[model samples]
Target: MSTSSPEHAIDRMEDRLARLPLRERKKLRTRRAIQDHALRLFAAQGYDETTVEQIAAAAEISPSTFFRYFPTKEDVVITDEYDPIMAEAIREQPAELPPIDALRAMLREILPQLFETDLDALKTRLRITAEVPALRGRTFEGMRATFTVLSEAFAERTGRAPDDPDVEAFSWAVLGVLQAALYRLLDGKTTYEDLPAQIDHNLRFLAQGCPL
Candidate 1:
């Protein structure tokens, strides 16, 4: 339901870029260029078959430069700018709303805009991540990182310690439902356009005590 187009997303990205110091803006641009070239290479070739050297060549950077941007080939597939954005969005949700409701609201607001920004790259990343064992293993690390982000944001909003047992449980529960929905998308059971609805449904299930 957001009429936000890719152009709108690009304009927003440009605005954000303009606010960064020149050096930081250059670094961010380089990082994005590397990721774009890497994803294209991954899509053209297979994930495993696409060498780091090849991606560097495509991006017109050295392999060492590629490593400076992404530590590993798998990192190119897994790393993204979305986590901090999501964390901020989580914190900005209506204070009166419960944590799960806030998260649901944030996803509803952000995901469509995000999808519009780079749906093709996201689809390629998800497909490659699903089909590759190394990427799958790497994602557990990413999941843990995401859990920390969610927990910290929830803690800030709710005035709880980030490490509090209740906060930890709630964050992991949200991660679980999100992971399940991602699996559905990777399995072709859901389209990108429908993914937010699927995530909303899953979160609603969790909010209802997760009855069997």
Candidate 2:
């Protein structure tokens, strides 16, 4: 019953979007539509087999419009919008809370957004990442990009240098848990709704120093 769960974060995002100018909102919708259709097409056909023109056609946008939103086809799967949001959430967590507790809260804040996401699309994306070596490399690069933001926030809270070993270790451990949870979910070991509980249990284990 955390107050700052995914639904709450979504509510905040909705409010912010509500205040955006009409043009900006329309742009956001168009970007989303393009991404949604791109994923659908990518899932139906293999990534290498799917062309940008096909994706654009499915989304009812021209190829030029697709490029305006995403620089390349790989960018659609590589770039993640949640990284900054979660990083900011982690930074905004109460200073009085313990490190793990703060991280848990941050995860909760984002999980609701994940819940609303298209699980089929996510599974397809993960599957593609697993199957494509180039995409896999890009995915790791994308993860490193987010890790920099998260590690800095962790360092600030711990009063350590951003590159301090302790900060890096803790950040990697957290990311590892999340990655494992995601893989398990994609592998059909867990359902979409079970993600929160699985993440909660893993975080609790880490909070307890990873007991056997």
Candidate 3:
């Protein structure tokens, strides 16, 4: 059984914040507060019915402050803190490891911490993203941004340009596997406890040249 808990996640986040400068830590705290309140409002009132003003009020911030952190309601739903963390973790992997192997290792280390952070909020975010038309349309934009982060990390490790065809292909392929896993979870075909393993399996398949 999973040993993850919300309290542990909060502790982990606090530990991370303890390392940052005061201003940056405050900014991150506010950002997390806004997102947390937004997700709660979205889940309770429905995404279309939950106004930015309401979310801002719930978060104890002004609507302008909301815009400062998230440009739009859609951004509030789709954006996350994971991409930068993933980029850094990928870069920190052993230089001798291949891109796919490095990704697998990074994900193995990161996914459990992520799942522990706030699985319920994560599920609500994914559900809203899947159900809302505006958010669904914006999913590709999010995917593009993630792809760029992944491609740049891979390029830096391999000494190639971010836009190189091989880098782009490998990055997009990883995204595809991740998207498939998310869809399965959203469809109730798999539990969150199994998601990391599923992702790892697909990455292994990709590493094996996707044999039939």
Candidate 4:
């Protein structure tokens, strides 16, 4: 699974989000494609060094088209599709499944897809994300968004506010585990394959609740 695959999952959701109106969906898809292209440029040349015009040219879109999708170069950095897809996944889970269990099930559906893609590109994305402060912040912000989306889904399903302490705690805990695992990977402390298991164990620890 390449890193780009999960991000591509975000692109597909952008396609679906655009569908309330046919024209709007088309716009959303184009914007997402532009963002993807821009990220590629940012990854290739340093984010600060890569100009919007360059990204637009690479994507075969107008510079104005780039501005249309992302107001600033930084905005384009914030486009991760995982939240919407994860929300959709949680929504699809059977009502009877406990919230944590539902999340675990949903992750199973999501993570395999990540690992299934071309590994090299994903590694490149990870490498870029790790090295760039702006990209790293944007990536974490995206993860925070993902956690919020999950918390909202759980709250809706379980009749609790998304911001309920437990929900917030669970959301952050999952995110924290993923961050830790990614850190391990980038730090040369663990293999990519070790991530899911490490994250799973951390989440399990959180789910079981910390003993006082």
Candidate 2 per-residue C-alpha lDDT over 94-117 given as tens digits, one digit per residue, 9 for 90 to 100: 999888899888878667665554
Clashing pairs in 2: none
RMSD (Cα, Å) for all candidates, in order, is 2.3, 4.2, 2.4, 4.6
- For model 1, how does the per-residue alpha-carbon lDDT over 172-205 read when each residue is reduced to its tens digit? 9999999999999888998888899999999999
Q: Which residue pairs clash in candidate 3?
A: none
Point out where model 4 deviates above 4 Å: 1-28, 75-78, 118-121, 210-212
Better of 3 and 4 by TM-score: 3
Q: Using lDDT as the measure, name the better of candidate 1 and candidate 4.
A: 1
The TM-score values for the models, in the order shown, are 0.88, 0.74, 0.88, 0.75
Which 10 consecutive positions of candidate 1 have the poorest summed lDDT? 12-21
List per-prediction Cα lDDT, in the order shown: 0.85, 0.77, 0.86, 0.72
User: For every model in order, what is the number of clashing pairs?
Assistant: 0, 0, 0, 5
User: lDDT for model 2, on a 0 to 1 scale?
Assistant: 0.77
Ranking by lDDT: 3, 1, 2, 4
* Model 3 accuracy (lDDT, Cα): 0.86
